[model samples]
Target: MNEDELFEALKATLLKEDREALQRLQDILDQPEKLSQKMSPVLEERLATFKQAFPKEYKGIIEKIISEKLANSKEELLEAIYPIMGKLIKKYTALQFQLLQERIDQKLKFGIWHRIKTGFRSFFFGVKEDEMILNELMSSTIDNIFIIQKHSGLLIASTNNNPAHQDDLLAGMMTAIKSFAEDAFDKNGAELEVITYDNYQLLLESYYSYYFVVAVNGNISSHQSAVIHEKMNNFSAKYLSRDKVKSGQFSQALSINLKSYFFTNPIA
Candidate 1:
């Protein structure tokens, strides 16, 4: 045997196992299903182990990385997290308001004797009874006011602290809801008085001609509801007319009056 043949023999002897392994890997790669079958169990097992150990083993590393990233990219982090933070805050606030309302309801359920005794104590102690009562009640602020035609659901007048789109749509929906509830329940002469969601309450006061829809943010007490009803009645008496509503004539003066009545002062 010459030098070339001897070198070839040596190379083959040294590289035979590696060459076979490479061929096998190439074959597996060419057949994707076979590759997946071979990898599935290994990948799953590794993932399971990683999941089991992750909190203990990688907690510090992950925290460190997050902290570093937050510190370095504060604006980007804020941009990414702001919406989620807002949603969380809104949810938390709503839950808190619900709890507060429940507490108020429980307090208000006290017997007449209890209230009389409390009133006497308040008088003797020189505590402002009105203020004390108000404080105990759920505080609310009026956000939007709408006057819609009773039967037609036409937007008669509206005023909102926040600019809103599609006032007509809201008026129509409110009317639809009122109509549905009245028809479904067949509650004669009993109209929809209030609609509530999350942290907002809508107080509806229906009249002969038109109705008032007051959007209040926060809990509205019985007293507040009565006050709103009185205000709406007065407004209807002063301004709203059946003929005007029927004629589809909405008045800017009515809008101004509503804004003046509700938005001029802080509603409690």
Candidate 2:
């Protein structure tokens, strides 16, 4: 049997034992040690059940808890709760893995990442694809689209659809970021960096001391920002495919950070 089966079996047994333990505790309030005495048998039985159910996976899980070499905090009261908590964690993890497995299977079959990239490309190019992606993303409650590149400036894309800084401001931001990117790439060859911009202003002209602004816009969702990254990655990938020596290091770094956000909140 798989881990899920083992978890379900263990959970059922634990639930029953929990109920019984509570009943016994209610009956023997005067003799609290009676509850402690009864817990050992239940723990042993559950472990035995797990061993029989998933013999291979059981040993590691059991050993980790046993090897912790720490005293149970409630040993004098409800002794089983400590072990039960551990078992519950394992059971919950098993269920989560099962669900994620199913999600991956379905998504992988349909080339979900590829499709997302395609959708993102449309958004960046300001075409039909862009409308679909932007519309869907704006509908969501996500705000603040942050796009960052290590050694480069930050691109703040938003749904405000404002062209306030369409020329000079954008030029200054790009120049500042490009300078940083060139310097870093020249030094490290391949390096990773992360930066954030808490606020900004209308004047495109400013002394960029610590970091520069690459692109600026109004309110945007986390989802739209991710789509932008995905498109940029796809764009870079295609370029790199043609010429292996292309400097896609910045794109790759941004994509890595974007990936963290995507995984945390997909379809958002």
Candidate 3:
């Protein structure tokens, strides 16, 4: 055996072992279940080790890679993240709305303590107690009053301080807004009570045949709201008969009566 022959013989032996190993690997690869069984333990071990060392070993690398990708493909990254961002924004907006509603509820909750405190302050200070209480609790004024036909959205009667008021247009608009709000919220027989804008508010009191829409200019306390509601009930009971209202028999007499009633006892 010379040098070349000896090298060739060693190469052949190695080649045979390599072929046998390759054949065994190919066989394992062909059978998916067996391959999974063999690979699972090794993969699990590797993953465990990676998880253990990830913070120390790969954290900086991952951050750098992400930073680089973001820097290089800013628009692409934003596009990918846009949907998630929108969903997050919508969720945040909804949460904010709920928080606002809760805050309003808190402000509106006039407990016994509040009444007592207000009463005591009024008694001691010798100020106009009723006015002071109204100021402290809620300084509201009725800007416009409307008695609207429910299904027809007809203007039964209305009164407002504004001389430039468009009664028919305002009535239609108010009815549309009320309808939209009720349908959108789907409150299951609950009426849309308050519609608020910058420094203005509309308080709605719904009834069977007709509804009362009172536009107010400030915060209305619970007591004040109840008083107004009671007044409305009285008005309805005394003047607006359901049959008459439904039959479109709301005459000028009834309108004049409504105007007189509200004007005589104005809500401040």
Candidate 4:
């Protein structure tokens, strides 16, 4: 065999092997499953590296873009949320109103029950309804009672045994305060009925000849006030007379009677 012929045969053999190898490579590319099997691990490794790096590299950029978009849409966002806020407020107000109504209903129901119980007690126990209510709800003490001449400010009679001068001074002060109140609001021409300070109350009752001032301490209910007024009226009718006014002083017997009427029992 010649050298050129041997070389050509050797090159042809190498080319055939190369062609077979190339055909095998083309088959792998044509088959999708084979291609994916070869590339999947490499692609997964690259994806994992990207995921780890993306937060460190691109996080700031993404946040800035979102913030800018929100800032630009602020007005639109408020417009969307305003209705929701109004609904929440309305719901809260409705709930509060319902709770208040429930409380009022409870009080009214309690009041009805109380009235029924009071009626039963009055019918069976011979206790006056209003008097019973005052006994339970009111507490008070009558400290002093004074009868003073209306215009002249003369101390006619007193429950206090203090000197006549102190009684006269107290009478003058009360007269002056009454005059001031009447004069200050003369348009209504209303008489001064009460003067209160802290837990003390001075109840005043006016008559044609004189007025009375009763010093009271502690809680006063309307029923208790009515009872006190009625008691004062009775006292005035029974004790006050022409001779009593002319004397302008409390006799020892009169003083004892006054104390017995007011101080012996509670106002009820």
Candidate 5:
């Protein structure tokens, strides 16, 4: 009906499995008699401890409670959703702190390709040598890499003795991208996708809203891509807040805009 409703519907449809799990989680919200007995003493103790440590923190907590209650003043009987939201926030914040406490380098990262620069210029220019290298490097495993965005149209990364036109290869890739975008966005929201070529090659494809497309290749499997997807989801949940200014700042810090720089120096 409304934007929020449509967004929720789209999310549920796209992430049917996840939505199912979330539905199971929602069942816990019902058994309130059990929840009241279970939650009362724990919440009181934590509130007391937090207040003793920092009285100022208690003020925000209380203000959040009041604001939630005021917002739901329409109902004759309002639910205790405020305390639940607050508790969840506190637990999640603590969990994030624990995750951050570990060494930075050892921290797990998404398996997405970190860069999309040409795999090797020589390989593109020298087609036979490049194919040999690709076969050697990727023979043992399936190469699952896909291009997210062509950094500079299709430059001759390497040359082969044959006289195949580079322009044809580039045109085909562009056509594939257009098809991929149609299939991907019609189903999901404005989101990146983890694509596979066969088994050993993985491509991380991202669209810049409605402007440009980007892709990168990597030597990873579909299973590995799933893991990376989970990690990226968590990263997004933890960092991308709803506040406009905060979102903008985080976008600048983490976002990539390659449309301009990528096309500036194209191969003739």
Candidate 6:
């Protein structure tokens, strides 16, 4: 009791407040509910005060530091981004070029460029009703249009009023020549669009039940060819699609349409 009691008295005197605080901390660690109860209000109030004060205290300072960093590193940023941007532009350009090539192929495949050297008057001048024929296209004449039946070589209708051969014979001859060419050339059911001879060229366009044979007298230009194609398409859509034919003929109407045909219209 003498020495040990003396040491205990001195230790307790020196560490009384610290020992009590440590015991409270140990108790808080042991009981989670009590710890939360004690900490919650203080923590929430501090967080609220921090949120209210943080932007006022630090926003301008943080913004200034970031702006200075970005200003100094601008060239570095551009250098890092340029390779990626160039690759993206290159890929986009390649896609656009592929689309352009496909369109050009379609145009060329349909004889769109077929007399390209001739006739640019339509582009330079405005046209109405497609009545004007270019003098450069006078070498060709819209001779006749024949509406002929398939397989039987029968004439449905014709714009040709008088001819060396009868309508039926002319129709039969055309069918025979077409069949011979298909057999020889392995045409594979493609419409024999044009048959060029020394004095004439025949433009053929087949419909569902019948076919059209446009007889041309001389060398046709690209403009003339396109106009003729457009005329046949328009006439067929208007007259041929309907049941206006009495016993399979709209010959007089077809004649009037052919009479209206000229060398040029607006190309588009």
Residues 61-163, model 2: lDDT tens digits = 8777765644443322222232333344445545664664566456545877756785577767766643444454345332333332222343322222345
Ranking by lDDT: 1, 4, 3, 6, 2, 5
TM for candidate 5 is 0.23
What is candidate 5's CA lDDT for residue 180?
A: 68
Clashing pairs in 1: none
lDDT of 3 by residue, 76-105 (tens): 454344334334444554566466556555
**lDDT by residue (tens digit), candidate 5, 62-167:** 8888889887752212222322333444455556544433322232133123211223443466544323333333323221111222232222111112335443
- Candidate with top lDDT is 1
Superior by TM-score: candidate 2 or candidate 5: 5
- lDDT by residue (tens digit), candidate 1, 1-268: 9999999999999999999999999999999999999999999999999999999999999999999988987644543443344344445555665665666557656656667776897889888544455564567778788989888898888995344667788889999999998888886667887888998999887666567899988867665665566566666656655565766556677778878876675544
Off by over 4 Å in 6: 1-138, 163-165, 242-268
Candidate 3: where are CA atoms >4 Å away?
1-125, 128-137, 161-163
Clashes of 6: 0
lDDT score for residue 203 of model 4: 89
- The residue-level lDDT of candidate 3 at 244 comes to 55
TM-score ranking from best candidate downward: 1, 3, 4, 6, 5, 2
User: Runs in model 4 with CA error above 4 Å?
Assistant: 1-137, 162-165, 187-189, 246-253
Candidate closer to the true structure by TM-score (higher is better), 2 or 4: 4
Better of 1 and 4 by lDDT: 1
lDDT of each: 0.74, 0.43, 0.71, 0.73, 0.39, 0.65
Error of 6 at 38 (Å): 64
Comparing 2 and 5 on lDDT, the stronger one: 2
What's the TM-score of each model vs. the native? 0.50, 0.21, 0.50, 0.47, 0.23, 0.43
Evaluate model 5: give its lDDT.
0.39
- Give one digit per residue, the lDDT tens place, for model 6 in 122-166: 455544212223333346677677777656556777866676647
